[model samples]
Target: MTTLRLSVLDQTPVGEDHTPDQALRASVDLARAAEDLGYTRYWAAEHHGSPGFASSAPEILAGALLAHTSRMRIGTGGVLLPRYEPAKVAEVFGVLASLYPGRVDLGIGRAGGPARDFPRRLADLRALLGEGGAVPHAPVPPQMWLLGAGRESARLAGLVGTEFAFGHFFSPVGGREAFEDYRERFRNATGRPAGGALAVRVVTADSAGRAEELARGLLLWRARKDLGEDAPLPSYETTRRHRWTGAELARAEVHRTALVSGAPEQVHAALTALAASHGVDELIVNTLTADPADRRRSYELLADAFALPPGGPETTVAHAARVPASVPAGR
Candidate 1:
């Protein structure tokens, strides 16, 4: 049996009636909670022009997470490499890696620009990070990762010799093929073992009905966002206020397929099976709930179900005095 590892993928969602500042703080608190619960990693996500998300710069957010927690790796889940110069990215994460040492990850993504030259840019990035002693120095190079949802991206990651993280939460289909292609091509080209993780959205509660209820806000948010009605995630009360149109109802059902929600044991079984099918030992979970408390509870339940050992007795960053004011806030 593959020894399953659980991690977190935080989008830093702006939940109901919360400001972007609040959303970012929630992410910090959640990261500390995850570390205490023994999640292996806590990766911040990047989003642009999205009212529902506050994490536009994951590198900055990752730094804050690193300072706030003593253990658990922190990373950008990822940085869209196409938008910025490779040298600049290397400089930023190089600083992070130096500061945090072994606990930083630089997850690269191809969110924009043409795909043809992506591999070249990735190579350029590695070189800048001291891949073959080509250039700039990094005292401790952060672990490199390629985040993608398709076969081509998987193949590119393999050819470039970086760990691959499949975006099962972004694009649920074709995961098995992507994983297989990455491993085979990586082993053949680099003559080294390949590593990968699958990111999936999940919601767990004490009861199945409660889990579904907690997930309702996100479902509504997704349905509306699909129709270009982007807005902050609504509260469950607010979600109940809206009258669902036939079109919206149908759309919600489609989005529903992307989620795995239930009581603790049920969600654990589903995630274990899902990871097995994708040939990955790690599953990065992305959960969104209208209320921050509910979101925290969801992770707490999952921690118990997975039987993860606690990292230590550390309180959340909520105790402002615990974290130095000099520590920058997560963006």
Candidate 2:
């Protein structure tokens, strides 16, 4: 069997009563659990000024994850490179690498939304990484990654000699053709003998019925965003309050590509087929289940279905300080 590394993109809820500290604690627990479950990485996303998705401060959260787990790699699913000065980002991640050593990853993206002034954001990032800046004493100057929806990001990643991860979960062209184009362009642009490896996000579940239920929850959230309902993100309870017409459901189906839901055997078959067909190097799993327990259970089932080995012994010496709760078995 082709080896598949499991990782999580944590978008768990931080209830209104919970402070950032508590929310971060919860995320730490989740990361530790993922590590114990033999996941290769725990990547958090960057979202500024959004509700429900409480991982806005990826740098701080990444530190917490690093402190809690010894082996699993920690990364930003993406830091909006366009949002901050590249020097500031370098400093932040530089500190992260210094503290955690080889466990840090920096995935940069071009998106920062329209509300923020784009031109100024771009200029800031350039200044930070361009030249004559205090370089972080990194072994290889950090493992940089570029994330985007199209070929431009792939080209940039190649030019910069960093990994390129395409946003298949949220982008419009998150299909086989897109992956093919990225791999081809990366090979040509970099002139590297080894083909470019790509990572994509997927939402998976134990059974088709449950998968559909979970997908409806995700689809509802996306639809609401498109509708411009700008309030704190709705709870799954609130998300379920809204309903979709048949046509709307069809649209959700079309948009929800790469999400696999079926019986355990069926899900495994589907994922394996996808890996072989696309030459994907990594599959990043994003669970959108409303309940935290349900979400955790989804990951457990997926790990078992994929026949992943249990995580090796925790590297306590490498990460002796600020260890979080020990992850429960069968995480």
Cα distance off (Å), candidate 2, residue 247: 6.8
Candidate that scores best on TM-score:
1
TM-score of each prediction: 0.91, 0.78
Deviation in Å, model 2, residue 111 alpha carbon: 0.7
Cα lDDT of model 1 overall?
0.82
How many pairs of residues collide in model 2?
Answer: 1
Clashing pairs in 2: 87-128
How many times do residue backbones clash in model 1? 0
Question: What's the CA RMSD for each of the models?
Answer: 7.3, 8.2
Per-residue lDDT tens digits for candidate 1, residues 142-198, read 788889999988987776667899998778899999989999877876676776999
Ten-residue region with minimum lDDT total, candidate 1? 316-325
